[model samples]
Target: MKLRTLLAVFGVALALTGFTLVAAPGLASTITLDEAVLVFVGLLGVLQGVRVAIARSRTAYEQVETPDPEASQDLPTPGDEFDEMLATAGADRREREMRESVRNRLERAAVATIVRTEGCTEAEAKRRLESGEWTDDPYARAFFTGSVEGASLFDRIDLRRDNQSRYHRWAVHAASEITRRSEGFDA
Candidate 1:
């Protein structure tokens, strides 16, 4: 125990002596003590300046921006209005004005599609849509001709508001039918 304690004390003393020799001013290195002090003080001053700048920037950001409320907001796309109505139709479950808007848009879309694909007049397209001759899907035909008022009870029973309404389903079916007809005509 005594020998170990002595060795530890000797090691510490030797380390301190070496440190003193190396840390002494006017040493073997080319950089003098004055130049090292100036460099350290300069680094500290730069760090302090950076801290002050960051603090000032934080306060500057805390102030209110310009008076224009919409300056930071994104602009709506061209089709956003119609898309919002469609989304409302999908979420609300019960059909209302939004559903009507969706139906109206889809009806127009169906007529336009008929006009384009069948190369018929607008009046003939409307007649086709009204007579339920545009597509073979029964639900889609009912959607335009008002043959069926609402879907089955199961289609309207979305209590969680997660699933789309029956009207949305009919819309999707109608759109797919239109797309299919358009593709077939093109082919």
Candidate 2:
């Protein structure tokens, strides 16, 4: 027999032996061997039925339970396509916004140098603006910060180059300016 079946049989035998031992000595009740066997089988059947019923009830209760969507939806579901799509879209939107913000900042920086050279071509002025040489230039940080407007040096470079160069140059210039200002130096 399988281990579980053997265990069940042993359990029943132990239960019958315990009951016989506990019976009162004055009560001379005679149960036939067949009747004792039948009673043990009946008890085993009842125990098995009770176990199955308890298991079925537990399964039914779990199946009927519904979780609140608001509480559960925030967590990522494993292997769920819709959840993955939403997460990807959110990431893409954030990246695009960051790129746009950088472009706007560069444009602002380019517009600030207009006053110094009235007739200067936008291309030449942008080159001058992006070159690392002008990082100390007073208008550089203001350009990125959106404080300066109208014909800044950034307008001189071609729009594409202007964006690339301005992003790099402005970042450096802005950092330096921040450090300078922090130390109470005017930049």
Candidate 3:
């Protein structure tokens, strides 16, 4: 059996034994034998359930980092001006594309959230989302909290690698960028 299963079984067994001992001492209690057994089983189920829940709650997820395609490859020697220029342009294009993709993802999510939660028009929602004061709206606040938590950088990389979804990958990057910009603006 898996370690979690084994541990849960052991915990339930212990609870059952302990409760049985306390409830039916020398068979002289007011409670009948059947009632004692029922109580013991109930305690066992609860103990097992608690152990399983705790085990599941403790599980954590992590993202695996993939090397950037541009950065991973060796650059041209310093003397090769044309090669270097091309490389720089390519890197810049990649960076811009990444930024644009992330921005689009964030905008869509933020605007949708604002529109849905605030009963606002798309234009107003888009404006509010771009303004960066998302916490003013109750729905926006909860949405941001959930998005940031779910799209955490560390977890999203692996999620991307595992082909979880395009939106998820972009959401993680966008959330981080938005958070960074907001921090600077606040300061």
Candidate 4:
């Protein structure tokens, strides 16, 4: 309660009272002086509330953002990082080892998911993949069992045209199928 703030508030209330009296001389005839003072006090309270709100909003905007280490712990998803690995693996011969690693990782994840959902042993889950009974997707079945020979003669030739592209497409489809199956879905 600084003297300056008190005086400013009092001055504002008084000016509002005078303005009300001058602007509506007809109302002044109906409303008593005590009621006029009460109205001025209420107006002052509303003005004070609005002033506080504006000051708070300005201060909130001016505050600097502080980083939290825990909040910054977001990591790239396994699928996203896998996509990057596949891109790098396809672009260069040196990433052949990474490509194989990625393939193994994808297969392992699928096998694990199948085992978890189907209540089967790992070997049985892999057997399902070998028989193409795990999923109805031809590319996924081919990719898992490493058999690209079952398509039509022309289709097989087309699939063999670019091994990298074919493998990438199979990998993406297989990943999606695995994700769908893991979520108790069949698509």
Task: Tell how far residue 1 is off in model 1, in angstroms.
Answer: 80
Ranking by lDDT: 4, 1, 3, 2
Per-residue lDDT of model 2, residues 10-40, tens digit only: 6887777768757854332566668868977
Candidate 1 accuracy as TM-score: 0.45
User: What is candidate 3's lDDT per residue for 57-120, written digit by digit as tens?
Assistant: 8889678999767656688775365333333433454555554544455567566655666678
**10 residues in a row with least lDDT, candidate 4:** 148-157
Give the 10-residue window scoring lowest on summed lDDT in candidate 2. Answer: 110-119
Q: TM-scores for all candidates?
A: 0.45, 0.23, 0.26, 0.50
For model 4, residues 137-162, the per-residue Cα lDDT tens digits are 77778777876534677766676677
Query: How much lDDT does candidate 1 score?
Result: 0.72
Cα lDDT tens digits, model 1, 11-105, are: 78657745865888445366767986786577656656666676677774456677756557688987578667777887886748778888878
Candidate 3, which segments miss by more than 4 Å at Cα? 1-94, 136-187
Tally clashes: model 2: 10
Q: Stretches of candidate 2 above 4 Å error?
A: 1-13, 16-19, 22-29, 60-187
lDDT of 2: 0.50
Model 2 pairs whose backbones collide:
110-152, 110-154, 111-152, 112-152, 113-152, 114-151, 122-156, 123-156, 126-156, 126-157
Among all candidates shown, the one with the greatest lDDT: 4
